[model samples]
Target chain A: MSAHLTEIIVFSVLFLLVSGMGFVAAKWRAPTDMAHLDEWGLGGRSFGGWITWFLVGGDLYTAYTFVAVPALIFGAGAAGFFAVPYTVVIYPLFFLILVRLWSVSHRHGFVTPADFVRTRYDSPTLALLIAITGIVATMPYIALQLIGIEAVLKTMGVTGDSAIARHLPIIIAFAILAAYTYQSGLRAPALIAFVKDTLIYIVIIVAVIYLPYKLGGWGAIFEAADKKFQASPAPGDGIILNANNQVQYFTLALGSALALFLYPHSITGVLASRNRDVIKRNMSALPAYSFLLGLIALLGYMAIAAGVKPLPGAKPGSVDSNTVVPLLFDLHFPPWFAGVAFAAIGIGALVPAAIMSIAAANLFTRNIYKEYLRKDATPAQEAGVAKITSLVVKIGAVAFIVFLDPQFSIDLQLIGGVIILQTGPSVILGLYGRWLHRGALIAGWAAGMGLAFWMLWQIPNAATGRKHFGGSAFALSEFGFDTPKTIYVGFVAVLVNLAVAVLVTFLLRALKTPEGVDGTAKDDYFADEGDPRIARRLPGTVEKVSST
Target chain B: MAEPESPHADTKPRTDSSPWNWLLLVPIVVPLLTPLFNHDEPRLAGFPLFYWLQFAFILLGVVTTTLVYRMTRSRGRS
Candidate 1:
């Protein structure tokens, strides 16, 4: 497919418009004070219904989910739609956990989950572990957003041949992203999300209707996809799941739902909402995106039906599967509309990249920098540190993409889901009851982290031909039992984590080891904006208490 | 459920919130109990049971959450 000049022009204009919005977002909210983490990091905690809706939508549905989800479906038929049930389950999961996190964070002036983890369990070591995990897990996700942008750029013919030249566009994109995020913080992404979501919805709706018409119909689309998969020699790559992959499909969905909220970026978005009601409303409404995702996944089949392939002169097997949707658009739609869709994918990457970097930065500033490095750091110092850290995190993500194969970043994201899921047993469980002993939690987290890494390290990919860290699925025989099946690594790791946590809890109880002081009151978990208990702090104030 | 006696501070005798709170977990649990309905027999409108059923369950989850949110609306947050 040829990249038309009109497509290039339209994509540039729309992207420039988004960049302008990102820069202008610094003054949009106009916080009276910019010298506090509350303003710079959390957007003054003042986003209302509409803003929070767009923000959370943009935050969760990243370029990775947009480009990568459809790409995965295009590459590996039904299993890639594992994202569907996961997305469906995640809203309900967020519906239950986020409101409580919002309420408690408001009550105790908590900014990050690590902060809550620090206070709830009163173990800086455990909090340190959680904070480090958040930062580490978020790095690959930011790399994923870069992968999204790179794919769009490649399809646009904007890429250069050499390594440095090929990545120059990504570097430039991320530089603008870093600059705007440094100036406006979370508000930058929140403002641009309105445009991103609208473009994505428009593109998806049009594609779902127009493309299927061009390629006969949905029946024909699925038939073509089934025929293509049937021609392939791979096992478990079809329009439907079989007995072998059913276990993997189910476990991946369940584990991902459990892990989605554990990421600091997701929690950061939730905490930025004006109140608990925003969180509640968004949870119910976010499922609308799941329906959209389902439609997007079908684009894979549409591409098959339309017989769309990579660009004319590209080498065989050199085609990045991520370009399927973009190429499909380039082949089917007019140049201008294809540009609009490319901008949506590009901006989709930008919004989540900003949020993920910001969240990672928040974790570093609050948990590591202030807690350990400078107990007496001022509010301005904290925000300053966070701002610088966000840039550094972006730089790290850039290095991850530029140095390693982008496929490794994808595998790392699978490993990240496994890593992040381990935090659920502590963060989610700690929100309700403080039953697990602190020592036990340490053991649990260790076991979970270790098992997740080990399990991911054991799995191999047939497509990539890597022995370890290949993808999210692992053999059941890793436990020395022969079963002709694979399961989500996160699910098994979490089970191991939970088992160790429970066992250690019992051992600690028998040994009379203290489960540190619960810094928060029982009522604090449920406190809302109007509640007398959660005194509304002024916008720019750091914690009044020394502990934070 | 065995409530392990916690010898920690701030034991304020927790009040039972509502039975509906447990219903929030239904959506999360539905996928795990896949043995109940993992087959592809009953296709809905040319979509396999394995596929469309997930969408149905997702709608069911959304409805369940909306119900719980409405019932506990006053209690959750104003």
Candidate 2:
């Protein structure tokens, strides 16, 4: 392999630096005890505004911003800019939803979303399902972050014909991530995120300013991208959305926005904030990152103008579009700066991957292991389980990359969005009040998840030659419509989920079926940091799951 | 441990359920209106109406949410 020795050196040094930070983070804000779920999994839940900003931004904006968005824009044209609107709309929803969740979570000492669900519905079965959904959805997302790192590595000329050679560096990177995360818990990512976001802001600001000026100008870049799209045969390819994909773009944007905070990682970030005011302020300010994402998406058009080609895929004759952004940087930027850019994307992947694994681990330990395996498990044992689970979760994500080899890493995330959206009826709706019966919520989740998977199974990615689970787009023709309009499967599935939930709720109420006891009262949702009515817990421990 | 009840607590002190919170809907609905900006005209600095308008939507979201937060934060725990 023709490795760029200079680029590799720079990338390795920065990566090692971040890994060191991850290890040292255990002492950053030393807790009295590290052997409890709240202290270990939620970073002591005392983050002020700036740390919350960096950590949440780092958690949400992710490698998806640096690697996946530009790659999609390069490959699919304007339809891919759905990421811009998706991020734009989330803050409004965040302001309305997250503050309430934070207050209630802090009030009751809930560590995961399923922890909230368990008390709200008073159904261990429903909470178990939510926990499983979060774990399953988060696994692919953690794996997608590896795709970001893999793309950068491939661009640095670290490749081999053998599978082990292709994945060895990624395995090494994640292993180090797992080690630090196991030691430091959420603090590891919270500390590293500051470094990650600063580097990203610098890299993106320079690329947007310098790259456009160097490669003619923005007009030439757009013109070149338009010209390429115009010559392509794909109906979805263009500078602007066509009639057929316009609905797809809107629904994809809206569906993805709805699904964003539903992921356990997003909730983990929100709950870790010190108070409701931090969440409220951050929700307004977080849209600043959306502006950065808009500029990042345009880098795809710049790639078109720069004529940056993707590197070869693991499979014969297949190209990995995930490599597009890294290849663009390698082509245009100076060697050292390009290495810095590569490090920015690689480190970007690590932040969310770390947060996501911790989130999933929390769900497993709280919802499953403690609930079923050992009902009286102490806080120390719970933290121990979560730490071990994080390692196992990272290993599972590594296996996803090494084995599955999906055509596009973004598709892995989209599939995750659909799976996680099924939990909305129980989790998000339950926040308002427990109007929907526990049985109805369970039925709705099953219906939504079933239809979402079935629809995904029918889509075939013509590029990858995969027969099923190809992509998230569901053709209207599948329902016998004689048109070319396609819609986001998650959007359609959630609608059915809500309808079934409402209809079944009416039926169950009419039949006089007894509902589970809601462990929270209305005032609990409004409880703040100093509220005495809230549950009092030991400094390091999570409160017991309130099973009525 | 129950704290002493204050005299003002009898009125169901719902300071957070304010009218200003509804203004947050503007940012959410305004961006979803794709026809408002999805076009080739009015390109700014090489960005199409589609591209530049999306950035404007981001600004719209920030301003609207900030206004809501500023108006609502003074009243209750939120």
Candidate 3:
């Protein structure tokens, strides 16, 4: 009877099909016993080159990339393009940083960055801080995925005026995701990523090519964007970058590129590969998604061209930018095809949300629960805890949806960027050298975390009705500068983190504070796939399956 | 040659001691320095300089990293 029903039916069928795949994925490349963190938490860490490529690609180019990147572009204009450079730079950084992490991880069988931190710095307190930051950073990220799903539902007209009616579909989606994740762990996402990525690619290619023709041309699209921005009274809303905002764009991209891989879920994808060479090959191949992302960012401009606006009676000042892409699809594509696009967004959220929950769970099981609560957790017990923790983490993410506005979760993500960047001095820099003292790293993390919150507390978005901790853009004028320049709070906070790390390190060294022994060999950072020592740790007599 | 004095050092690849490993820094450092290429002039096909150069940098990074992987694969790991 209704036009949106065809979309609802198509989306439901695909979501059901993927849920079926999620259940069956537990047996994909089946391990003999899925009782260990390596086996359950990381898909046995046996994925070869192509599989790793899709898995990591699927994990990084998330619902955020699909929804928020375009949404931000639609809302903020060119600054939304920051995600593009961040991802472009991410591949190169991944090429360099990931293989080493893979090598060291494979050698020591380290599952989380906190595991590496504990052994590298021999500081449980420091590892605990890292683990907690990862869990906190990721919960809001998982919430953003719900926002993607919500935007899709909103466009599909499934959302009702009542709160319970609105959140019903989200609850169902997360329930399916949570059950499968609890059953399958990382395998669920690893298997579903193939479908998610394929749908995203098809939807994007078709939309990018087809949408421009539907409107006028690229020239017309650009002109419309320029006209809108030129008419808007807000500063820095134009199609081009001004001097005041260039530094913010640059630093945001650069800072986010560094922060991207440090998130536990991202590293989980990397560490799941069979070996270092798999990581290297995947690094080169993953940039192809960045190419896809560049095309996806253009969706925002297309939405503007299509004259898509927020829903009727929606506040103009508090317009949901997240709705732009789905609204674009709903208006232009046929109902069934729009359904396909919505499924793409919905499943896109599923893959990352699954993996993020798993990563957070692993950090708790190995670094927090196992390290502190139960030093004697068996492999089975550890996996058990991680499974339960994964469920708990998913529940926490869902709470973000049920309790707060979706925009609040988005702001949490920016704060997440600021907080996770604090780990760089200890994690990324430590991968190259161990010169920074453990006590110094602890001090640095506290300083970075403190400054990140303080900076966040200072940003006020008047439109969103936030007086403090409103967004990521820190006004340079806040620091008494004459100009209108703003910087990424994450970048400045990270700089403070590094400075404190260096200074405290020298002081600790001069005072001769007992720097704990480094547990790793210098050569461990360069280990490759066929290294016999590491290979022996693989499940005995289980043949390496090259399944994608 | 690589301070094999550390007892466990020889257990894994010696690729780090090779001269070419330093090249990995190029892909990382070039992209991290934002002020180096943060302009919007000379728009390519209506895309700003800030946008198009990043795609080129991605290409450059992949090539350099692939080259490093090839060069190091042949000469080191013993």
TM-score of each: 0.94, 0.96, 0.94
Residue B35 alpha-carbon offset, candidate 3, angstroms: 7.4
Model 1 docking grade: acceptable
Number of the top-ranking candidate, with lDDT as the measure = 2
Q: Which one wins on DockQ?
A: 2
Superposed Cα deviation of residue A42, candidate 3 (Å)? 0.7
Docking class of 3: acceptable
Q: What order do you get sorting by DockQ, best first?
A: 2, 3, 1
Which CAPRI tier for candidate 2? Answer: acceptable
Candidate 2, A274-370: lDDT as tens digits: 8888999998889889999988998899999999888888788999888889988898888899999999999999999999999999999999999
Q: Per-residue lDDT for B1-78 in model 3, tens only?
A: 011234364352365445665776776666555566566577776666656776677787778778877776666643
Candidates 1 and 3 compared: the better one by lDDT is 3
DockQ, all candidates in order: 0.25, 0.47, 0.30
Q: Tell me what TM-score chain B of candidate 2 gets against the true chain B.
A: 0.75
Backbone clashes for every candidate come to 0, 0, 0
Q: What is the lDDT of residue A176 in candidate 2?
A: 96
Could you give the interface RMSD of candidate 3 in angstroms? 6.0
Tens digit of per-residue lDDT, candidate 3, span A55-146: 88889988888788887777778877877778767776787677788887877779999988887888989999999998999999999899
Q: All models: lDDT?
A: 0.82, 0.89, 0.83
